[model samples]
Target: MRAVRLSVVTATAAVAALTAVTGCTEKSSSGSGDRVVEVTATDDKCEVSKKEFPAGHVELAIENKGSKVTEVYVLFPDDRIVTERENIGPGTKQRVTAEVKAGDYQIACKPGMKGDGIRQNVKATGGTVAKRDPRLDKAVASYRAYVQAQADETLPLAETFAAAVKAGDLEAAKKAYAPSRIGWERTEPVAESFGDIDPKVDVRADGLEDGQEFTGWHRLEKALWQDKKIGAAEKTLADQLIADLKDWQKRVGKAEITPTSMANGAKELLDEVATGKVTGEEERYSHTDLVDFKANVEGAEKSYALLKPVAKENDAALVTELDQQFAALNTLLDKYRADKTSYDFTSYDKVGEADRKELSDGVNALAEPLSKLAAAVVAK
Candidate 1:
């Protein structure tokens, strides 16, 4: 329960012992450099074997010595999560590798897998300067431009949706909702970068927001589809949504996007479909989940498109598999499109139970291969 002070020799020996016991070399097991950091996570805190290290490739072999399920994170300045592992049960160990830049960062241990997390500062000093791969640099530039284009498209459509709501035109507002959301969904990471406005723009009605009034797309959907009317109160939320989106456009101008992040984003969008869309929780009121599903896939597809060149060059077989999976998954979804635009999109509710299961299976199939993309891109 007390703070631990592990000497570097002890930590090094511990890792070496672990390597011997598992019959694995540290570098091979972690895809990390020889430098290892033992991060011991407990019920309420995290203990680092080393308070500092030279910047570059590092691995944190996390030992969850906690009583409950927990997650741990290596954070950049201002608490941007760099890499994290979740759902580590009691007495389990998980390894997370990160290519860290020279800076001060924090270790966050969330004992319950939810919270701001208990944090402790750690430093990375000068070392062999980590150089960016030109391919990854090119991918990052392309992804950023995509986000900018999506944002540029989103603003005006948001205006139309907001105006329709203010005018009490439920039919028109409903028409505008899905299209407006496409650009926003494609730029999910950008929405997240703005912090305060993300939930306001996209939070589902679920209690996840800690009772934050659920004033986003689902909120507007309820007013439009369920109530069949948009009152002044509903119009206020619409105005705020547009306001937040415009703010996101400005803030995202300086935001960063990396290949690893791109891969994570793609995986996360698929995860969203599996966890939320399939369950119908996200589109509880309007059953607009098919719209969300399509958008998530589109966003991920764009990321994959950027990585395609590097992926093809390095792991041509894997790229071919992913390409095939994506095509199959899209073919499965194209069955539900009644037309070319969001205007004629089919609701997830219209699909029979069996058909929905088929969609879920298809998404998982793509996600299985898609999950390997980030590593391939990084390894390349």
Candidate 2:
């Protein structure tokens, strides 16, 4: 599927509403002094008093007057340096201080929301204010909870979708598919975990009543849904669909294992807060898991690009190599997950450090060469 560019129309509407309620004036903080920026969130939008601040330490005071959970993100041009406040629940306020350099900057809110996207251009003058948002701690807690709930909801939905297909109930399957998709769609941060399953195939069109029947597993589902007879042809199609789903499940499961497992471990650590037992300090490798997963993804993406034409031409060698690469990565990920969960963090100080280091190194090794191969293949 083609990637859709994010729209800022909702953001504009949000900004307008915020501007009106706050009655705040925009001023130039470009001089050699600390500046105070006030930002507020409303039901329909987020508003900032000013767009630009001086190039220095700037303090942002964020207040949540809206009924829903709101977050404020300050984005740098590089896209890496970001400061965000999450879950500033209604009637709450938070503040964060960031060192601002003289460059283009934006203050954006409700990043993933459809009609709540708001961004304001800010120009920093000179000097900076070093203030921290007291509400940030709570916001992080709220965000973590939100992510956990989303994961819990998504897993079961995927299972149900598979069951719907197994039962040969197209209508039931169609209803089930959307809720299952919501789990993944709402959790956009982990959307990349699904690997090469085209969104167009799996999520968007899988259970639709549309007349167009595509290829792969979804086509099988369409056959079961539209075809009335449960004869040899249907059975053959169903069997093929099941086989394809199993393959897809393996890939999707592997993708979920690394990130979801890490998240699970992290959640356990957070849960242990009441007991004051933060085990696996160095052993916890969430960051490493993400890095490795990203590398594998890049490699797979590369191999796909390179092998597409060859596979189309019925080049067995290219297809075989691609399969091997995917299988190897899949095996590595499985082993890493098993190793990670083997040790009881609470029992040992080192926890899974050795295993994590090994996994990290393995991922790094795979990502580099795979990326190169994929780039070469695509180039050819």
Candidate 3:
């Protein structure tokens, strides 16, 4: 089948609104020492008339006033405290009492539901609540722009990969191949819409470079670039790679798009490369792959960015928990760059089993935090 390219899907306006309106409140109660806050959730979203609260022992009354099943959760900076009420039907209100510290926080609803997820900033001010920060809006905008810019750069990277292969520079080709592969992989979700295309048959394995039979795109590039005699065989190889590229572009344009799907696709493509399974005559490295990888990284960045505002606003006990996960992912990327060959499954032993295990463990460490974050986003 023709390889699929990956692409990112943007969030809708409705989803944005759902997340914007859910506020938190802290108010003086009848008692002398503590405060009481009333939080409500509608089928569509959550609401708190007041957006700020005081840092101290507080009682939060979470009410479900809408018709659908819903939930209300208060996230702490440390991610250590999460209070939730499930299956609160229409007109039902459940009270969850918890001690909240003074700081910034986030109120979330529908933990795993899709569309119009609810999230609101909660600021604590000397036992009083405050308004949302204007700076946060700007930060979100900046992040979105950054991701889109990375997406725009994919096409040029693909072309560079093609050129590197044509030039017969193995070293350059290696670098070029990564970006192109990453682009296609990251765009795979959207590419799926084009359906599957069988690999072209004319791309053969007969060519040799430096007396060695070459396979896969990298091997093909080596032969074409190193071969001194530019003849019919070279032309055939170049034509095949071009055809593959066209096929890839066509498929990637049509599939459903999402950052998670794109990231998964990039991971798969990288796996294929490491395993030496990508085969076909028309294959050439494309710079687009690097763009796709960057896109995936941007997706992770978005998740991280979203958490920062939430952490600062909510004093969620888990702030450090979330930050550590993002840091681990960054470390993984750094290691990958430091030794691309380390990802080669065939050569795992060369990197040492211990190192490989460390990499594996690091990725696993991200699963819970990512799932929690994704759940927060999808829930809305």
Candidate 4:
């Protein structure tokens, strides 16, 4: 959802390796120790400190020295994402911690947040990744089930939206739009892990690559709400949307899910809300930003709930803060709707600037504490 361009690979090629994480650890020529890699991103180069290091808990200390927003990725040979941090704004620094086994990988930086990005070959030499808590295992398993369920539930709803689009029923398609997006909004990072399907199904008009045709929900959304007609082109795009999503449905079970990734992904969801939903950039035509906003919160909360047990045991104070912040944000969101349980909220455009500022503040409050979740779960 953060507009990271990864359409270079065909969807078929992307789904070829459904599993992103490997169980086997390679023997490292270098002995096991903590590895911290420094990355400097500029307009033209991706500078990684070391090309090879022992694998285990590797931390990327990244600084965006460039003038434009950038994204950094640790990718498998096949371009499957190991872990990534997107939307690294200009002149900002972020530290990302990921567990890796011995393997060959590439560290890439997309200066303008587009294309395959500048790449450098890096190797995780033989080293053992430390064992995780058994409770963390349960968290991973439950989160995987939750991710898959969201994917399963999404396809049917998307099909309903596509059906209306195909039938040229403008009103029905409009009504189905926000509902179809809920599941995807909740589990977007899982969808994005594939590196191909997201661009196919969710790319916005401005997010398109050079010579890439725009054909997704937003395209259809534009036609229905802005262009005011569902013509043959719209119908064809509708079919494409469903086909792409069916591919996503098939691949959700194979995505890489870890406690840290869940925690990281939850933060990414909040970033998504802050950048897109809060700014009214997403759902620009339909004015349904609040619906997507709610879905994003729901997805983040689900991940937090799964990891809460271990996190609470590790850092009770952080857990308490997270709980308080989440409640405060939810309470703020609830004011937009008459019924708290439903997705039917006031359109984003109708919300005043004062209200939008409050929502933004609420997201920041929760996100600050939520950022500590991964470390909490990984604590000894």
For each candidate in turn, the TM-score is: 0.80, 0.32, 0.39, 0.91
lDDT (Cα, tens digit) per residue for candidate 2, span 299-353: 2333244334433344455445555655564465554344543311122233376
Candidate topping TM-score = 4
Whichever of 1 and 3 has more TM-score, that candidate is: 1
What lDDT does model 3 reach?
0.43
Question: Candidate 4's residue-wise lDDT over 1-380, tens digit each?
Answer: 77656654543443332223222122222332347788888887787777787776677888898999998988777777777888889999988777678888778788898877777667898857677888888988988888889989998999999999999999999999999999999999888877888888888888888888888899998998899999999999999999999899899989888788888889889989988899898889999999999999999999999989988989999999999999999999999988888889998889999999999999989987876777787777
Task: Output the TM-score of candidate 3.
Answer: 0.39
lDDT of 1 by residue, 265-376 (tens): 6766786677677777777777878877888889989999988888788788889988898888888888888654534567878888999899899898988777667667
Best by lDDT: 4
Q: List where candidate 2 sits over 4 angstroms from the true fold.
A: 1-33, 76-81, 127-380
lDDT of candidate 3 over 189-262, digit per residue (tens): 23332322222311124322123333334445445444433344544554455565566554433333332222
Candidate 3: segments with Cα more than 4 A from true spot: 1-151, 168-171, 182-299, 302-319, 332-350
Reference-based lDDT, residue 88, model 2: 58
List the global CA lDDT of all models.
0.71, 0.42, 0.43, 0.84
Q: Model 2: how large is the Cα RMSD against the reference? A: 18.2
Q: How accurate is candidate 4 locally (lDDT)?
A: 0.84
- Per-model clash counts, in order, read 0, 20, 52, 2
